[model samples]
Target chain A: MKLINILSEKKEIVLKKWFDKIAASYPVNAPSFLKNQKNQFANPVGYTIEETIEAVLDVLINEGTDKKAQEFLDRFVQVRAVQDFTPSRAVDFLFMLKQLMKDELKDELQEKGMYEEFLLMESRIDRMVLASFESYLKYREKIYELRVNEFKNMAFRLLERANLTFEFKDDDPAFEKDVSDSDNVK
Target chain B: MPNESKSDELKQDELVKIDYKPPKKDWMDTPVHFRHGTYIYPAKAKNLTYLGLPNPREWSPADEDWKLPDNWKDIILNGMKERLDKYRSFKVFMDICVRCGACADKCHFFIGGGDPKNMPVLRAELIRSVYKGNFTAAGKILGRLNGARGLTKDVIKEWFYYFYQCTECRRCSVFCPYGIDTAEITMMGRELLTLLGCNVNWVIEPVANCYRTGNHLGIQPHALKDMFEMLLDDIQDRTGVKIEPTFNRKGAEILFVTPSADYFADPGIYTCMGYLMLFHELGLDYTWSTYASEGGNFGLFTSHEMIKRLNAKIYAEAKRLGVKWIIGGECGHMWRVMHQYMDTMNGPADFLEEPVSPITGTRFENAKSTKMVHITEFTADLIKNNKLKLDPGRNDKLRITFHDSCNPARAMGILEEPRYIIKNVCNNFFEMPENTIREQTFCCAGGAGLGTDEMMEIRMRGGMPRANAVKHVHDKHGVNRLTCMCAIDRATLSTLMEYWVPDVKVTGIHELVANALVMKGEKERVVDIRGEALKEKKGEDNVR
Candidate 1:
């Protein structure tokens, strides 16, 4: 299948699992919480789920192993920073999901001896996302600094390039001597 | 017996002597309308404010401090003198006035207040006296001897108030054999007052603001874009018409124009939306420009130089945009400036092509020759040519009487265009008395810059005559709706209606047209995309 379709299917499964875990933990008003989705969900980021998923799939299209997949996940955090979504908000959302999973699936994970492995995966994802978010912030700050410096340089250059002239006084003795010399020459 | 008879004859002679004594009552003692009377002061006096001056008794030479630069003054004065000399029609009318009172009863103020001084001629004389005092040697010396006052700060203040009251309506001039225009005198007076920095704070402040910002209401470009987006959303909600109000669209076929006031202020924006929707329905290629957006020239309130400066951008923007014709909005002075002075100031624009109605293929003659057209005229022409589908029944209860704005009717002879459109769309259309109907109509008391709360009493007194005539029809024939072509007239008259005659409502002619025009089934009138209609609908629903 296409890389976009595979990514989209993965995103759907992950989102559903995340929501199910939350619902199982917070059972009292889980349905109401799920119904009141934000504008981002209603409008969606791209034309279709596949199109949005394609952006992530591009990083791992020709990957040999899980390293490239991990790298693609790390780049997701960078893309989020460029989109101006808060890194803290993303971290909070991830923590909420982890809490939900702990409450709902802890027993099952322990029985399967997969709890430590899942914890390690979560830690790796957290480090990758944080590093990428910091880089994006630095990039924006550097751009702002460059613009201010360029503007100051331009202003100074404009001042230097402006026309300048000197006015000589007619009453000066030197000016009188020059006039007299010119008249004699003529 | 002979002595008694002699005494009786002496008594009779005493009675005759008593009869000959000069009547004690001067007509001014119980003046019919105190508002219309000129509050005369000493000619040489400083600020003696009768008309809303803050410190009326104080005499300050602060006006002198605000004097124009020498070069600017020279240019302005020379340009004015040249224009005065060049405008042959105005000169002819000014020179030939015989002071006949045929137009005296034509004034709404005179009719309403029963003030003889409110007569258009006597009001014109107030300025004429000053003109004679300053311009001529005989007038300078003899004028003071004959009750003329030298132009002073107080006089300037008075000019600002009274001239603004005149509404530049040429209704009186229509009746005069000489066609003596009060609007010209009002314009001259406003120009002179502006030189003294005596402009109304409300008006001049906005004009200055317009100069600084793109629009008169000081709406910035980014804010305007946001507002348009909001309006577009509203349009979609109301009529399901998904259209964008094109901003700064360069190289459009037509420059879709309206007064900047409409975009910024109420009732105006509603009408603007209507225009936008109509244009959208027709699928016309047009764009709105922030640079040349303002149709109402406040410079027309002050000087010709100001008028020229304000109008300079219009033609330049049109040429830059490569548009064929500029379609002006429902503004009185805008149309007047466009119809009368735009070509004269800008000159024969050879670059623009003539405007043609896209649907009908009927060519608008002299569109390039003339730089602008009044929206009403354009719409009326289209309706007359049977280009638009209109249902008169939609305006079943609307009994509209058109009050021809002074500038368009008297100054530019634009009378029938609005009337034709009104009649076409509205079934219960009524014309006022023949004299008051077309060119001979009275001012709405507050025109020019005179529409102030302080001047309300005077405005009412002036509008009294017009109100009396309107009331006459209202009482007898059930004519409750007062429709006018001028935005200033709408502003002033609507205020008058709210206070003096609450029975009648004043609205723009376009508002009525927009109301009555046939729309597709369940498709709301696209005229007011600002969601004003939704509010009205909520109000109606509440009532129901």
Candidate 2:
């Protein structure tokens, strides 16, 4: 069987192993809890990780991305973006997929003489990593936008519109600092 | 520097090291990472000074020296001891945990963010360890083995990070066999931090504003009246009933006080209009208290003492106005304060009569002691008695689900009132997943004064469980509208919904209530309080 065909058969094991790799990224005790990934409500992070990784793996096998696949990636990357991960670490799970594919199915690809399929799959994972980076940045940017929008979402804009906001006059003593000013006033 | 944690320096390399191995250090020994988005800004010196809180100084958490009082250690220890003595519950909670870890996965923060310390039990242990080390002989003798750590400045920093991280929503307490109120523990942790002036700006600034003005936002009476006039304008445009609510009037039958957010904030302003429409329809006798404009108490986030000081104004205004009883608007922690703490903290409401809905003649037996009835309970009773003519079809455009806010659900046991009102008011209403509603309800993750902007990342992470449940229904039953009964939920869950489930917009329950309320001689209602046209077709995704 070819490497892609073998991956199709071994998809379940590959998913479980890939889920383990992502779980390893979290803190120690958290993984033990996240390892029980069946219940979605109780262990949302685990469930999302399992579900999204499975979907991302399937997308890689098809050698492209779809809306559903991108959404799965979006949801997963959204979780990581807000988490304690840096930009690279947030999307590094995609890179981990390439490493896992190599480690898990290395001999199978070598024996099957399908370096081209392996390269194609690796590049696709690479592309997915790039896509995950896009999603991660989208969420991070969304968080900052949400922060700004938070102020506007309140009675703030209305306050400004109604001219209720107290603006300091340019000539006001409080607005203009004198030469003999104390830093403590700030 | 003390601020730059060892864990942070090695975080990037340590995170991507993809080997199946143990955590680098024990959780107890693990230094906390004060990442930018994870923490809130420190309380500003002015806000702390305005509140007369201790150790007011301008310093950042990332600084080498926090400018804590020289005797900060003694201050925190003494404060802890004082609280442990005064509140026996604190002492019992400090000693009683078996750490079976029932609450580990229950925390929304931990469930969403996967942070180990965000676990309710461990978060409680963040302070409880110090309680053990300083208070218990066993902990002092046994040290880290007994899960006891000293109250170092690092420990205080960890406390500020973790305690404020909690929304005090009490979801984890629902699962605890010992029935430990983790929210109280968080409150205690915050109280000790307050001694060192180590509270968050989001919380302390609100407390200060509430202390000076009657509300957290510090809207003066004229501005408050102006805001109400704006709402009345919206009400006139929508319903054509000119609401003439008396502010701080003498001898109104009922004193109506809501979180000031209702008068000003988005979506909450719609709920405020809903209250106006309902009152107008029923001819309910109530006066707004400009002095007690805030029903939500940020003092509950600060200290028990502060809760009393901020809460005293409510009763004082009720007395001064001589309203027979008080009707609090839809707010979560406000109700938690009114129900659980208000009666004891600033009570003997002997000045006011028991709350009886003047329209329906149904006495609010639940709030007989507090003399304050929740709007939902009042509205529910009105619907129950068929006193108000509610056109349920008016809400035909929306499919709704009730998000039982954490305080109202867990703290106050207000499970049925909102459901009763929703069923009587709306056409299509659905419950979220079995575990995510009622007493097992997840928090908006923005309660207990953590509902600020800089902590958006943590809030998003913490809101995941609530959003995930909302998503479940949004996918399953086309739940386009998420109606909650909290002011914080109104302001914050809108952001959360915007982030997690973008299509689902949040509404206060009364906003739905008034949409169906048949007002007296009102014009043909075309628009909801938000100026969105009623009976508009549900477009592809949130086409409002």
Candidate 3:
């Protein structure tokens, strides 16, 4: 029996554990709300996490790559990034998959003499943590950029009120240049 | 250089809190602070100019001088006088408030952001104070003692800050003893602010887009067609069903108009797919018009006249395409305008008969005057009449909850229609807390053009109330999905839920409907509408 074969057979348990681990990072009350629904709308955050984990597992088992899982991963981490989590704490959920898989499938892997393969899976999880960290940083930067833009727009608005800087309507030719210049208005 | 104190830097997790204090000085003496997350960037000059709005000169909320014309005060005061006589509701609302403070605790912004200005009564006071000082005789005699103060530039700035902060959800109106809707007050305040050329870019840009391209996204007819075609491809790949929807086709019985965001964006696109599949399932004769692509009117956020201008196209396109009536897809403020304001603003839609759901023969008395039916009402009627084949088990994996959008619940009383459809389509449907679900429901925290990215901090803060309720239900009943009928809810609630209630996600009611609808002769369906693979049927996968 191969490691991939065992994973394929017990993917449901693996995915459920993965989803539970990620959801547990939320406040204690939120996990119960997140876990009970098999429905997507009822447990959307959980559903998204479950789908992402499942997609990741499928790619892992088949030795294939899927961009969809990364997209889901971005959403998962982006949410955490905006929360009270620090950078490391935000991306920590990605690493839980390794422990969860090792615990759930340890017996099967050892009995099937697939110890090396388990280590390989650990490396894959390690790589995912890095990817997720990058995503988390990107989201954090975006949030900071937005704050700076708000400040600049406000400063310029006040300047206009003080009759310091000039103002341009959208139709003015200067408007295009002003809006397109260095400041991130969008 | 002086040594910097440790408190000079804000903690990573600590959000800034600006507390309201009773001033030692008079209300008129206090200066305005255009704080981030509370104020919005002013409307671009072109958008205002394109619509021929007054004072189209470029202005920013951050500016010290707004570049107002010398006669600006007179212009606004006269505008108020004209509006007082023209719209009796505005006058009645202005005179009715008794400072009971009942509506203060009712607003979600106050609950989430902890800003006293977010309190409904005070938000109303930002403008009501002006109305008193300028319009009423008591204000003239009593002044600040009687809650009346002269309208200064600071007062105008305060109006821009607080009015834009409101989502116009009307939850406060539900609590007001006199039924003095804060939304009506906010609309009037926003209208007055527009007279100062002080509109937000997020709103005015959408209004300009809707006016010029017949959609809020400024999508051309070719781009709109391409989007629909791309969705068709995705549908084929996911469900193995090829659905061809008619676009701008003449002589169609119904003109189906949805928010342009549905045609272009995620989560909304899935809902759009749901609409296409549901329509195809019913074999409904409807035409999609690129010329009238937007069901939402951002102009509602600007002024009534602008709303009327943006809305005129719906009936005009309906007539041109020879559609007897219109069926609106899921949207929020669009419904508010259609249900409460459309007929009066641009009606006598007498050329079209009352909209009867063709499948169920249910005549929508609520929409009889406008000759428009909401898609949820249409679907609920169909389910009630047993018109379509449904397999609730297809949604067995979902434990869903319905979020009554503020406009539909408060403005249109569309509380039951969506719940009826959700119950029929899914097996595990739970309601949020009693206070948080219906007419008393909290806003998605991002509506009325406050849904922009720059406002994310306030949006998240404002979402706290809705998220708290969702957390309560999610913990108590194990509910995870938050279903809403509004397009803005679908777009913004996803971000809100992700930030506040990390375990919950959002979807449109129609998306779940499409998930459960068992199309005739369809191939084995493996994945749901969002392209998530469904669990294999028991004992079937192994046998295969």
Candidate 4:
């Protein structure tokens, strides 16, 4: 049997381990709130990570590097991207999944002489990691862009009120359009 | 050459290192300097003059001279003396603090910013120290050693920085042994600061606008009608239901008022749609006021006199329109004013009867003095009576949680009303952690007129506690949306949610209610109020 099949069978164990690893990165007080709480309402963030990771794992087993995998991976990576994680740490969760799978499935793969398939799986996860890194960068850049846009909007309102500028009007559709472009006048 | 390379590496390391260096002079000893990313721009001369606020002058917060009146110091001292005598709670809070430090860690701003002054105790101490020197004999003799200091220009600057940073969420009051509310202290501090023209533009401008045009946005009657027309069009496009709401019509039995942001801004506009649909369904005899268009009082951030002046219009309009009672919309500080200060400031409100929901027949005894019911209380009662049909599956796409607006929860204790409304409408719902919700809830970190983006760094820091709590729920419950009642929360928490938990979107509670309302003769629902597609493939994983 292939490593993907074995991995798919033991997906629950692998996912629990992966969830714990990602959650452990938060401050010590954060984990009980993020990991230990079973009530989904009380702990939605923990539940989302588990659900999202499971979906991503299914796509990896069924169809590697496909559109479905990209979609699922984007949802998962975007969470970390907007969090307090540095860029390297944001995508680190993707790489950890491979190590977790290899460690969890070590004996079964060796017994079936599926070690080569396991190596292929590792390379596949590496590709997933690369994709996630790109996704994280895009989301992080969006955050920076949003901060700039917020500043421009705030500056325009303050300046308009102070009568220093008459170029912008509140609630004007045209004013909101390309506010970054309007910064040149300032 | 090796030494030069090592020095270059050291310089690079220093460049990236986050600095938390205390200024060379003690913050208490040093005159508080206005730092960029901390202070707000000054209120305009015209805005101040329009509102009849004191010291109506063109002075920037960043400028060296604020152009204070000649007797500014005396005015502040005498103002404190009058207020201390008038308000027993303010006097008790000023005198009774043991500085136990329990409240220091309780504040979201203190936890997030790590600024010692952001601590509720020290923030109050900024004023208390002056109060001591001016009022007490021991303070006159002991001076700085007894934590009493003479009020000076630097002290006024300190009051401006620290008081505005407070959202008046009252989290600190929850932990204090004597129940000393920092909000009361912050209000008093702001009152004293405003005595010297030390008010921010974000607040004074709104006060002026609300005073003149009946709304903080200064939206005129014609423009207000045009905006409502736009919402009517959007609602028809999304839900195939046309709602006709009356503006400034007399003898309507009820007068509905909301923050001006609801009419003009995103997310809030969606909540306004929720109110319109609900009101239209009931065929309630209510009229919207173009005159008392605002429920939010930014004067709450300015001074008590200004709060009273702006709030007077609500009761004044209600009396003129001959409405039985009022129904206020989703707003945070607005409710704070209405619940705690409005009746005292602008009442007897004896012209209006106790608010009885026309649909549910529930009497809102909590607002008996003010005779105004919060929309959440109105709707929650309606849901309890099975007055409106709801389709929870329409909101299947969202896993939701509620952020209790600090004022509503702490001030009015209207905790369960919004939650009851959310539970009845939406199929998927979650609660934030016990410590971060209800009366113990954290501020959006940008409440009390500090929501401007100029102070993004400090705002982010202040938001960290709430953001951390939000991040917890988002990770645990697959929660994608946060719903709140306050207009400030709707505006500011959006940025906080976007920054820390990007996947989660902030929304007003009524928006969720509207999505699940199941209106009569509505076309097969396809999109939500925002015109975003509702999840079509339901019954896949109900999970509930």
Candidate 5:
């Protein structure tokens, strides 16, 4: 397969998971918040929903696109991982979007008598998309690890040719077992 | 008749000897005491060679194969003249100095030899006259009036000889109120001479060889390793101390350093042995890097870029070893390059931890943490802090006088450190007169790459002043031993002392200290009046 086709396929998988999470947190009363034609009335609920989706896209694209930006995000993620940030933070991001939209649209919804019904529908969709986004973030980490391992292998080969010695800890069980068996035979 | 024939045969042998003695009454007669005996005539001619004013008729045009361009002579003359003018300091010094002669007596050579040309002002005038004739309109118009002559083969020879005579000691500048540095003028003259392909074979050949190989001695890595191993064995045999001089060991706590010459030549290896023994005795963690082993920068004799290239290895090796500090062995220009120029050229070291003496717990105040240290200072501090158990009586009967090297004393202000170490180790110590010590000291005449046999006449003439001072004390106080800190000074002065005054001996200060070091269970390590080892074991087999 062409390299670009493979990259695009992987990017589509990542983007779909992100877009579904945003759609799930969409307000049921978003149309009401967008009303009052020719008036300067604040549409806080619609604005909140848009801003949250934009922030998530900014984070995802910053990590997934620009090479330097991705490296920086990887470094940040590694540091956060050391500090024990779990994969469940993706669910918390969805819940924050819902809370902001509810608070913003409550006054207008109350005037229309539709506040309780809209919140109930919005929350049910949030759970389904949050689960998918969490799994996508885990898959992104795996891809990063594979690329780093390939780079390290090339560096080791070059260093060997230069007559420099570098020994790493035996982390791969199969490779370690093979080396130990060869040593025993020798 | 047969006896008469035997007498005739004896007479023929006597006749062949031909009383080649001087005339009874001569015009060039020196005082009876001043007469130099058998070697005096050759020695006088040698002194005259240092004046560097050759006879013009000796010049011979080159053969066709190596013949210079027809206009090459003129081109060189004009180029040098223009360069002399462009140098602001040189121009200022040439035009400004009145014949006050305030700097006359200040030069160690002048005071020692009593030669007028050895005076700083007169020595500078030799080159300045050539400058004036070529550069100035007045000088060109009235050549005889300005004492400038046309550029000739004779002038080229004179430039080679006299310019090399100046050691670039910078002692004369101290007495100049206008602060005219004669050393700078000497450098310019030498540089111009080099451009005309006129360089002393001894200095230039070694420089070329060093460029090809990594060291002045032209010893490659294998030879260097072998020499170090040999010296290590010799050290163990001599001092009964086994020292493993580790090579290229990464993450060693310190880097044991020495001049590259030590890895190849004599007296240098002895000093290297001294360093190894001291390090071993202290039980310090250090390693030798073949890469950064050369401490002496020959480039300092020629150009700045060469200096940078030679010195680049030290810090690179320091980074490679992950060491805390670099400890340099006993060398002259090595310390000068490290103490003066290294940081400015290859610095801002981030990896180095600030040095606090392991024994004393006192920090070096003005020193860069990563830069360098003279081994004398390090060892002296150890002795001062009561870390090294030394017995002063070990050096008894070795009446010693110290000759300060120009670079270390004048350039680095390293006067007291070596002296302190020497005094602590030796029971009897003497310093030269105050004027001849420290910053005011004269060079051993073979400094600045002028240490060659072809230049021996000039070297001795230049060193006559220093030799005379040493003779004065030797005559008065019976002081026979001269201890110096610089390797060049030791090498040059040893040659000079052998030829000029054979009664005295010259040796490195570390050699004296190493000789005097009190080994475990040895009562003393002193040399008796006759220069015999007094602490020899009974029935010990003599190897040499």
Candidate 6:
């Protein structure tokens, strides 16, 4: 079988192992709750992890370098960004798939001599790790931006009342287009 | 050279360390790590001193030594002992938990952050363990085997970290079979921590502000008047109806109190404007107070005594102003205290008459004891009686959803009333999934004084369930406006939405109401209260 066929056939295998490995990052008793409580509203973190990781594997198994991978990974990263994990540790699980895939696909890979194709798919995950790293930093920056905006907004109307806040004076004609777009009907 | 190469390899190994393996130690034996985003800032000494709380000294969680009182352990024990004796509910909650793990994953913080410690069961165990270790014989004999531990500085540190992490939203209490109030456990944990001069400044400073400057942000009377004057200008400019609000005026028949943020903060100020416009349209005899300027009691987050001290002003101001009944504006915990604790903490309110909506003549039997009606209950009555003409089409440009602020939905059951008002005021109103609304509402995750900017990260994390549910409607129904009654929701959920679902805007329900209300002698409405351009102009919807 082609390496892609093997990957597609073994998709459920890969997702289960990946989900279990990621679920272990939570403390004792939590992994069970995450695995068992399948309701999205009740187990949002688990749901996000489950949903996003599948989307992530789909992007890899189908489109090796899908641009939407980062967006899929962004939902998962939003939970981890504010969590107790370091930036590298937060995205480290993405790299675990190589070992997972190798172990699960060893017989198929050795028989078909598909190590070269395996490396290509592995490199796609490497790029995804980088994408998630970028997402982590992006969310971290968004958090700081949120902090600044929270302070700014706590008194936003008060600032407007005091005339401390004002519209950007039109130095650029292009800004008018953005203004007009906002005026469009929702 | 060989040693330097080894160091480089070790550093690389540490950098690439995969954190998939759970720590081998038990949850209690595992060392605690207080990451930056999870913990709140310590209370300032001045605020503590102002409230005359014990051990008023400057301290930070980062320091090696927390500068605790010498007898901090004894103080906490005694405080716990006193509470266990005084509160039967606390005693029952302490002894009653079967640890069935029913509430284990119910917490938004636990669900989003994935920290087992944030679980309502475990978070309660942080204190319940101490109760076991110190008070129960089985715990003293069995120790760690009995799920109990001694009250040490590390235990205190964990308490401060975990308890403040709770918004005291009581979503957990909704699911517990025994109905253990984990939010009250957090409140008690916070109250005990206050005995050690350990509490967040975000809560304490507001308590002091309530004492010193008459509101949470310390906006003085004249400054509050100035802010209201700005709202008056916006009202006049938008609607061409000139209305003046009476502040601390006597004989107004009703005294209106709201979180100070309503007048001083964004989006909340628009809600404040809505109150003004609605009252002016009915010509209701209501007055705002510079004295009871704050309806939100940050003291509720501090201690019950602090709750009494801070909440005493409203009744005092009510008596002084000679108002008949109190009408609290859109706030979460404020109504929790009003409906649940106010009469007990402050009194029978014998001086004030039962709240009878002047326009609709509907007696608020629910508020007869406290003599304070929620603004939604009052306004829903107004809309019910057809006393106020509404133009729901003015809000046609936006799809809307109501977030039942945790306290109002769970504590007071003010669920349908707010929805009733929202439906009357806006044509497009969708409910979030059943699990995330009504009595099961998710918190804004910034309640109980955790709403400060420094606590932003966890607030966002803990707010995920709420944001996720909203994301459902936002994507499925194209709901862009998340209207809520709580002032904290207005302030914090905006940031939460920006992080999770940036398309959605957090709005106070009344902002929608004022936009739809057909005020008398008003000019052609051109803008909504936030000064946004309106889609359907006055009388344009009628023609359509």
Candidate 6 has an lDDT of 0.87
- For residues B56-124, could you state the per-residue lDDT of candidate 2 as single tens digits? 988887776888889988898888888888999999999899999889889999988777889898898
Off by over 4 Å in 6: A155-186, B1-19, B540-544
True contacts kept of each: 0.00, 0.61, 0.02, 0.03, 0.00, 0.74
Please provide TM-scores computed only on chain A for all of the candidate models, following their numbering: 0.42, 0.79, 0.79, 0.77, 0.32, 0.80
Q: lDDT per prediction?
A: 0.56, 0.85, 0.79, 0.79, 0.57, 0.87
Q: Could you list the CA RMSD of all candidates, in the order they appear?
A: 32.2, 8.4, 15.8, 10.5, 38.4, 4.2
lDDT for each residue of candidate 4 in A81-140, tens digit (9 for 90 to 100): 544455676677766687677679878877756888877777777877888888888766
Write the number of the candidate with greater DockQ, choosing between 3 and 5.
3
Candidates 5 and 6 compared: the better one by lDDT is 6
- Candidate 5: which stretches are off by over 4 Å? A1-186, B1-95, B105-117, B133-153, B263-266, B346-355, B519-532, B535-544
What ranking emerges by TM-score with the best candidate at the front?
Answer: 6, 2, 4, 3, 5, 1
Candidate 3 structure lDDT = 0.79
Against the hidden reference, what TM-scores do the models get?
A: 0.59, 0.92, 0.73, 0.75, 0.59, 0.94
DockQ of each: 0.00, 0.38, 0.03, 0.05, 0.00, 0.57
lDDT of 1: 0.56
RMSD of 5: 38.4
lDDT of 4 at B516: 84
Encode model 6's per-residue lDDT on B1-544: one tens digit a residue: 1254566656664655445676667677765676677678899998888878889887788777899989998899999999999999999999999999878878988888788889999999999999999999999999988988998898888898888999999989999999999989998999999999999999999999998888987887877888888899889988999999899899999999999889888778889999999999999998999889998999889998999998889999999989899999999999888888889988879999998987878999988889998998889888888888888888988899989999889998887888888888888999999999998888888988888888888898899999999999999999999999998899889889999999999889888889998988998888888778898766745421
In angstroms, give how far residue A3 of model 3 lies from its true place.
Answer: 56
lDDT of 5 by residue, B387-466 (tens): 77655565555677888888888778988988998888776677666666788776787777766544444455456556
Best model per lDDT: 6
Q: Alpha-carbon error at A60 in model 5, in Å?
A: 99
- Residues forming the 10-long window of minimal summed lDDT in candidate 6 chain B: B1-10
